[model samples]
Target: MSGSTATTTPQTTIRIPAPAVTALRDALLRPDGRERVAFGYCSRSGNDLLLTEVEQVPDENHRHSSPGSCRPTTACEREFISRCTSRDLHPVFFHSHPFTDTAWFSTLDRQLIDRFRKWLTTLYPDRDLLFGVLGHEEMRIERVTADDSRPVAVDIKGEWELEQPVRPTHTAAPDAPAVDTERFDRHLRAFGEAGQTKLANTHVAVVGCGGIGSILAQTLARLGIGKLTLIDPDEIEVSNLPRLPGCTHGDVGQLKVSAMHQRCWEANPDCDIISIARPVQETEDYLKNADIIVAGVDRVTARYWVNQFAVRHLIPYVDAGTVIETSDADPPQIESMEVYIQTIVPGVTACFDCLDRGDPDQAYRESLDSAEEKAAVERGYIDADIEPEPAVIDLNQLAAAHTVSAVKRLALGTQPPVAFRKYDDVSGDQALLETHPNASCPTCLGNSLALGDSTISSAADQEIATAPLDDAALANPLEQTDRTTRDWFPPAVTAFFASDLAQHPTTDP
Candidate 1:
């Protein structure tokens, strides 16, 4: 009689969810524990498998067995196997590794595997049963056979290093919209055929998915940005509904990155969206590959992280913020709404530190003072006491649109506006402040280009770049200033009035 040997294909290894690992570790720590240590295996989906449930095994505690020993009762075994089969999950043999250093498997481990093999063979003769060795420091997986053989260690490290799963290219759902080839062509042209080629190969990271960020992402997607990494831990709140487009009431508790991914896909299906639902600290690897970073976060902590990351990587970062205020005493009186846009080109523009060092409280103080002034106006006049209706959606949308336009201009090699535009509805006039970098700005003092080998010689040794201002022509307000004036209109004003007689000739200011 001739005998044939059966060989099984190697099982693909995947990362166990961190939570599940923690749960298993916690289970092993119990002492008088009748706790049922349930184990089930499912094929890897994306990063990890969803651990469905764990049922408690009663009166099955093995006190005499090793601390890690998972000697499930006959009933528990049958129940586990039944549930796994119903859920189409495989019954990887389950055993506990007591928190000990002994490298070799105990005799009990072999006996338990033998018992499980007998049952697994009857149910899945062709398939191998997986065995998990859960220890204090590590967890090991192996395969078992019916011949009362020792388990084979699963190579976890080797498997995890393999490339990501190759998903079908056209796996998009049937209801998904068809590709817009014409818009794609237009996007390519707008980014410059050569530029679009470069951008397609580049990866961009957006730190926040708020008002400015949402629009920024939309613009990038429409521009055919090849790869995008979105990092945000916030959920869509009711307060954010007015500013955040593409978000609905249903998305109130949903992750910002998920919402952003949906919007990006709808904007451009070809663009890749890497959604990171965790905080920025937890997603450094995603930040490492970013070619350009768009900072639309309102928090100082988040902005600091972005600034540090951008400075370290020499990546260009565009920062945008808008402040809207209304007087308490005046109805329809917009106290002031100032919009600030700053572009920090790694080696070119002064870093944020440089600007902050000069006048640390300048921006914050200015914003606060403006807000207070608006509040005062609202409180001073009895007519203003009447509460003004909340801002309309169009106002926030208008701000976001301008911000997105600015980002596009920067990406297209156009110089971004440096003047902070203050729209004052009460005075019916707009104030423009030329936000020039202070020579003593601390942020810029020690800044050295990331790409260059040269280091900053000394804080005082750095030279400041200055541009000449044409103050003489603007001195006479009666006479029209240069025709090339950028108007900063107040909220309720009809006519554009030049605030100062002098026009700054140099673009630096």
Candidate 2:
């Protein structure tokens, strides 16, 4: 009678079907001998590993051949996880190392293991899972339990027993609505739908297809932007994948514009994707057709060029930049992620020249000068000689995102941020929207902020006198200086003074 009262415990053994393993092997062997293996596990009770839900390790190829190096690709990882989630499968990824016999895991390998354990614990603390790390000839298995104890190895009958290729299910592509459908549907019913329709009709142009530009293009595409024009002269590089969205290791060496076009189209086939694989200077004509232009460039020279084009064509240009400086500590720490966003609406707010001058080197020098001396000057200084260093991708992307948000605000006819906005280092996040009434700015001369009557009259007089008096006039240096000063000074000075000149005229005039 006592023996008849035995109780049963739940079994935790995970089974990976045989057919799935074969498919994974085939997939890993494709694209010549270079292809690598990756897999995911799915389970309902949140304990058994579902081999049907597998994924290719992101950035796995780089460290695949090495013992402990790995760089995961975000797009690939996201794609893998999304597909699995859609099928109601939990994620447990598998990747291979090319080494034949590496007993100890490398730093990268340990880091990856640590990351996976942490992620699983955070997402599913009650679920037990297993992570597999396959070597060139040996397979290693590590089991993760609900408790934070050491992972133990489990022996399988065969190495390739659970290898199977799982293809992503095909579904009809969803329509991209212009508006914020998620938030709208969640909040307002009819108005949100209507707003989305309006958003679908907007078009955007991104200038610069490097790190920031590429990511911006993808974001806009995914957000269901109606039309997009991507411009860039450089080709993709292997190093760009770590930062740029929609790009893979395979995309390296391809034209950035072309890659972006392909990727955007893939993301939202209905959205228009135009490619301009040339410098912005060469594609000025195309820019006129855009409703909004985003400048995700590195050079101040390029920014100035964009500024001129945007001003001339009355296009809303959003300029973004990042300045990264390391501290002088034993282990250098990034001083700050100095992200900046400038929205230039031709006749609305202060243009780039009105916010601040384009020369960052000059700004840096000014920052270093004695505070008393720097403050004593009435007219702001200009460093015609300062050349800024090349900008990096993180700063560029952050700035681009800010610029896109600003554009969205403008497109929606919301109160756009004041004309000139600067997010200097983090502390300077305040929006400054001052306008210049008497600004003799070469950039915005005929627009919202007109030059003073005296400045205009002076300019007219100089133009008439220097109006090409035949070859004899060209021989005088004074004539050259006069013409050059007239043409360049107002713009240069306007940039230095920002919107301050609108309050009071420069005494020098």
Best by TM-score: 2
Task: Give per-residue CA lDDT, model 1, range 256-292, as digits (tens).
Answer: 8899899999997888899988878677667765656
TM-score of each: 0.43, 0.45
lDDT of 2 by residue, 1-509 (tens): 01111122233323333333444444343433352547564443223232433455544433443333444465665565555444334555555544332223446656666776776666655444555544433334455654542323221211222333222111112244545555346423632554455446667889987767777788777666778989998988876777677678888899999988988888767778889888888886677656679877776667777876765555667876677777779786766657767776654445777655678764345445566435544345543344444356656666767776776665544344445555655455555555431266657644322111112223334444334434432333233346657566554553464433223222453
Model 1 whole-model lDDT (C-alpha atoms): 0.52
Q: Count clashing residue pairs in model 1.
A: 21
C-alpha local distance difference test of each model: 0.52, 0.55
Q: Model 2 scores what on Cα lDDT? A: 0.55
